[model samples]
Target: MSFTLAIVGRPNVGKSTLFNRLVGKRLALVDDQPGVTRDLREGEARLGDLRFTVIDTAGLEEATDDSLPGRMRRLTERAVDMADICLFLIDARVGVTPSDEVFADILRKRAAHVILAANKAEGAAADAGVLEAYGLGLGEPIRLSAEHGEGLNDLYAQLAPLADEFEARAARDAPETDVEVGEDGDEGALPAFSDKRPLQVAVVGRPNAGKSTLINRILGEDRLLTGPEAGITRDAISIRTAWDGVPMRIFDTAGMRKRAKVQDKVEKLSVADGLRAVKFAEVVVVLLDAAIPFESQDLRIADLAEREGRAVVVAVNKWDVEEHKQEKLRALREAFERLLPQLRGAPLVTVSAKTGRGLDRLHAAILRAHEVWNRRVPTAALNRWLAGMLEQHPPPAPQGRRIKLRYMTQVKTRPPAFVVMCSHPDKMPDSYVRYLVNGLREDFDMPGTPIRLTLRGQGDKNPWKGRRKSQPSALRKHLKKGT
Candidate 1:
């Protein structure tokens, strides 16, 4: 029942800029290039005391069928349809164009409520464009510069009423079902520690990857012994800390090594323990040494997180020592892009865990990725995206028979697992599955979280079916016949 506010506009109109402004962090990639944002990105937005889900959609463009621009437009349209309120952003510096008019028409036909925002409206230069925005017919536009943080009070005032209305509607429509907490006596003396209560986040990586240092910084003390030794920490330790007033129980596990070279019993036990920690953790922060980033072991660990269905955040530690930091960062990003395509947009943060630099950003990224992990896209909107995906690139046929993926539903979250019922589950190729996972990751803005897709054959029959009629006599007769 969360309210969603979608920011929509043509390319280079500062939709991502406004998204970063509302989300209060520069999570979305910003570049001078047009259409840098190919996917729909979402974040939990806060405007003063007003809290809502804000979605940054792909730039709207007019294109012919089967083009990238057309697919991007379809993605934007889907986001607009799912939103309760739409914030239509226009570049006040450049004024409205034909693309803006087309999108405004689309919004007029689809969106229930719309708010016009004139971005880059700083000084007197933007006045004319702000006035020109009225041509869209949405209403008077609120002028602001996302980069400079100008005119936010007006934006807050505009959103407050919509937020209040959404809250009221949600309260009215809320279901009566409530989860009952069992008492200690009734539950046969509940354990003093409930492992499921506080969110468990695991910090894992290779040896000397700053796992121990990061934990020490987070706890603000020498809780775990940190040394120059390769395997200084031998056991997984759990510490309870409140991050930004949110209670979180973090698990710091020993560094993992390659299985073939695990010589000692202690190292084997530690590796097994680390794997178990990954399984238990709701979110896993994979720490990587900036000196040797994205090694084979790193990829293996990330793949393990994906296989285990855990939210992942890749942290590059000791970034301060690197000579060409930006260059190294770009190379690392490219490597991640090429190597781990499954986690297409996984959150990557560069931090100096030694000096406590970028800790705040790392924490924020972990929290944001966790939010995406727990996110659930509505059934209607998911189906809409699925239909668009199919139209864009139809799945390939196997043995002259088309593989029809009929329906998709989110069966579980906390690493968002989905079930896509199809005609032939076995015939579906791995490449096609990767295509769908990438599409879901991009369209749903579920970055940094492992998305699980399970294919179930439509023709598979349940064993429980028709079992009610066959009693003990039928089973005995079948046994006798077999004998």
Candidate 2:
């Protein structure tokens, strides 16, 4: 039996610290600054013998307008509604503030089960604040030091009974197992996850390119924080959801800027985290602002994806606002070919992340790109193609001798790496290698995906090259002479 717990509180109340403690990871970015987190980050948490889902929400704020803080507050309220339990946190050193009391009133009316916690309670100075928490009318506050790992036992004691109760209610509500639908319009099988493993796709671009907005539209909910803020996302938050029945784990990364411009320490960490996500991802979507498409930083990011051997997809966002679509798209294509020749022939999808338009096409392009990335070629087909290519445009014969490509075979996939057994491998020119790579891409339908082609000599090491006859040969000669 499983249940979800949401950690909620005002800014810098140690909610993220406790979340990390519960999930046993520093998944959420934490800093001394207030309101570092602005999204609903969920993880599987284990406390003692109990295991369940936990959500780390943005700090409760007093904003009610359509500002960033207000949006963050709305997102947190959604988490409280979705979670089975809410761990309301307070700063024991500072006691409860007006914002805390206001949110407490809200959570009392909304949350099904609330557990008040007085965090940062390790020293005696926090005792008065902990005592002052009793006036909030939620319940007795548990003294906790999330950084030092204190008060977890008390937290566990509070959660065990609730866990058992949830398990009981789930058992009661569970449908019967011996039922099946005939051919009529009756009930169907229970919902289950797709049999395929979730495809990992990372969305990366410069700031304010609508990466998080696109993800939220696909999720059909406001799962990520978004506003006019360019860098609302501070961490590479990965959300697993099925898009049109295909399971996927999508990462919403922080907007990347030029290295020289990124001076803030926390932004540096956030960018680093996003870069890590790009490396872990199989397909990377390089989003572009339609108005300012293909800037230097955008090209750098796409080139980074190609160099990392990730399948690349270029998505031009904000198409709804573009005035001359045809002209702009043609210019974008020409620029893409002129600048990013490595990712030539990749699918360039035009989407409006705000209106949720062209998402179906985007989905198809991603799946197709992934398919091309993981494509494998048979040795026979590769050798046949190699023979044709060699015949049409032979290798450059440097000096007097010709470089012979004796054999070719695919060594691996996931970016489709290949090795060619050839004589004078070290003498092959870069231009010739590029020719062969271009031929492979054109002939094998592997356009836009990174292709690794290696040249190797067949005789780098021979067993009998420098060795004399064994002692057994001398022994045989001596025996014959004696005979």
Candidate 3:
């Protein structure tokens, strides 16, 4: 694990703002309203030359019971305990309040390394407040303006020694590098397991479609809060787990409703958070309620996933209550075919998030989708397929000359992208491109994964490609003399 820094403060003190600045992105939901952040968000933070893990925690409240604020407090406390250091922030504009005093005392007892920071200390208005922060007895406060990217150098100065210590410890603890040898004592290629990276999968859908239920069931525990209530999940909480022995990280996002219906500021943040999860995930499961599958919003969500180029898996939740199983299944197939033509052969697995039925099938489908998303085809095979395709239905030429496709090769994978060297590529019709893409999908067994096909015409060096070469004047005169 890397050095972890947990930012702790009361609500609206710019903890998230500081987090966004450090991470170089607006990952956490930032609002002027207090208590906007209700969960712990973690990001890889980079400040100057220091790189470490930074946690954005929910604001601390005075509550100590099991209420919502209380729960958020516990989560924040967990983050504090898990961190290597705690950044206790006080709002310089608001000055030190009783809540800041309370949290400061708590951090004094809980954290080994506590750094006090007075945020929003950009102008003379906060001078008195910045001086007042000294009464907390945690040492000189680092005056900061997180929104304006001020005071980071001082922050980095505080963190440099810690980062150096962590790097030294990590280097000391790292295992010696060694090469694997075959049974015959010859060096061998590294095993496939060496390439393992945590797979990110996000479960998304409309409100109350069992998104949380499905994720909890897959995890085999009630790690995430869930109930019959719609919109219970407000943050995109990502849980790390192993699915059937394969390491994976699953994100349970807030259910996204239509744009007009999302009026609450908090809900808007939640929706944006969910969209970010989808964009970050490697595979997106658009869980739909079987009773009301393929709603306009459902189609929109699936389309969004597809357009993002993430591998998609359509899952029908609440299958146990579904009546007329065979009829419903057939109808689902037909509806999927009719509605989502772009994701033509994407996996549509039926599962009951409540009863956990069909979970194994869903797991297999997810793994398969991930595999197809990362699939690669060899250059030889690609050119061969291109040849067969051109022979079957050659590109249509608008003028007299026929368009020539000279070379084709896979440019990259992870949603296989190809580039075809050709003549008159600009004139190639969209219909022909679609034809080639469909052929690639069908022949490559890469159903539902996005395919990128780029057509490139002859380069400038080959400017006279389609023109006939005229005989030289000297050759023409010699031929006339011979006649």
Candidate 4:
């Protein structure tokens, strides 16, 4: 089982900042405004060699039982209940307030284990508050500045013991399970990750589409070589980055071209490398040139992602020089619907990779699309939807015999795949299958991620019955002897 940790604190106490620090990404929005985080965001968190799930919760605030703040508090309480440990953060610069004391009391009552953190403890300003945190009775607080990345080693030391204890308990409970070691070493080794880890995002497009330029701008450095030259990047190179404190691993792929034009051996190699990057990526951002958007190659790349069952987001790059922005966006939407019908509702964000205009929106759109792609529709809701669909348009009869699609169940997620057990699998037409897939995408709000519908034929006989053996030989011999 995955270990869970919750980051809890009052508003502007640097909970989001500490969350970003632990997760190593700015996934949670950080603003000076109080109560900015109204939702609980959970991600895999890593501290040194320790890995666990971490939930970033909304700030504790004053509200009635039915109010929004109260609802947020309930969410935080739920996180506390689910967590193996809680990291209670306080702003050392501001010192403890009545709200802090109230929340501390709540945490004492709710959380199973608590680790106190004195955030923003950079200068002498925070010394008094750090000393005052001892009054909370949560144990010694680890003083650190989340923004400047100070005192992390001390934080790790505090967490390592807890992690080791959890791991030891888990191992003791599962002694019979085989722990196979892989070529890399211990197969059972704890996964190296945390929610603050960078998201693995790949930028793919045809040659000379400014993929390199976009990556450089995002990094705010000349990390990847860029020029007016086409096919400069011959191999996929990944760069580790933090966007607004959101850890992101970006793969800049070589520009892909048609198979026929990729005659050169180096270009062919580059294409293969790019393809591999796309396969490995969790989310693919297809960058298109604003001047020549939605070409045959672009459609093919998008189709490749759908076929491979990867999440996709389209970015129309170099929009700074585009003459008719609105018209182009409209036409692009139509073309996406017409050409790449499978990814009909996938997000399309227009950006000038040159000027860095609309990059934020682009990032936001990619994150949202990824969330939808990874979404799981509950089995109950799915079956209800399926029943409604079958009621509206019953399966077509083949040879005047009605094909019974008996039951449907989701077999897998992450590009949700469903298996529909039916009377005749071979008789199901392609049109009807497409109808179901389309309906699933539209009704369930799953766009961009490929939906797989499979039909399993259930034959007319009960398979569990034992085979019958002939017993007439002995009786026939006995009758002959009597005669």
Leading candidate by lDDT: 2
Tell me the whole-model lDDT of each prediction, alpha carbons only: 0.83, 0.92, 0.89, 0.83
Q: If ranked by lDDT, best first, what sequence of candidates would result?
A: 2, 3, 1, 4
Q: Candidate 4's error at 433, in angstroms?
A: 0.6
Which model, 1 or 3, shows the larger lDDT? 3
Location of the lowest summed lDDT over 10 successive residues in candidate 3: 186-195
Top-down TM-score ranking: 2, 3, 4, 1
Can you give the TM-score per candidate against the true fold? 0.55, 0.93, 0.76, 0.58
lDDT of 3 by residue, 103-170 (tens): 99999999989999999999999999999999999999999999999999999999898878888989
- lDDT for model 3: 0.89
Candidate 2 per-residue lDDT, tens place, 1-483, comes to 989999999889888898899999988888888888888888889999999999999989889889998899999999999999999999999988887889899999999999999999999999998998998899989999999999999999999999999999999999988877667663566343353568899999999999999999999988899988899998899999989988899999999999999999889989998999999999999999998999999999999999999999999999999998999989989999999999988999999999999899999999999999999999999899999989999998889899999999998998999999999999999999999999988988988999999999998567787888767678799999999
Between candidates 2 and 4, name the one with more favorable lDDT: 2
Which residue ranges in model 2 land beyond 4 Å of their true spot? Answer: 179-196, 460-463, 469-483
Output the lDDT of residue 294, model 4.
90
Cα shift from native, residue 285, model 1 (Å) = 0.8
**Judged by TM-score, which candidate is best?**
2
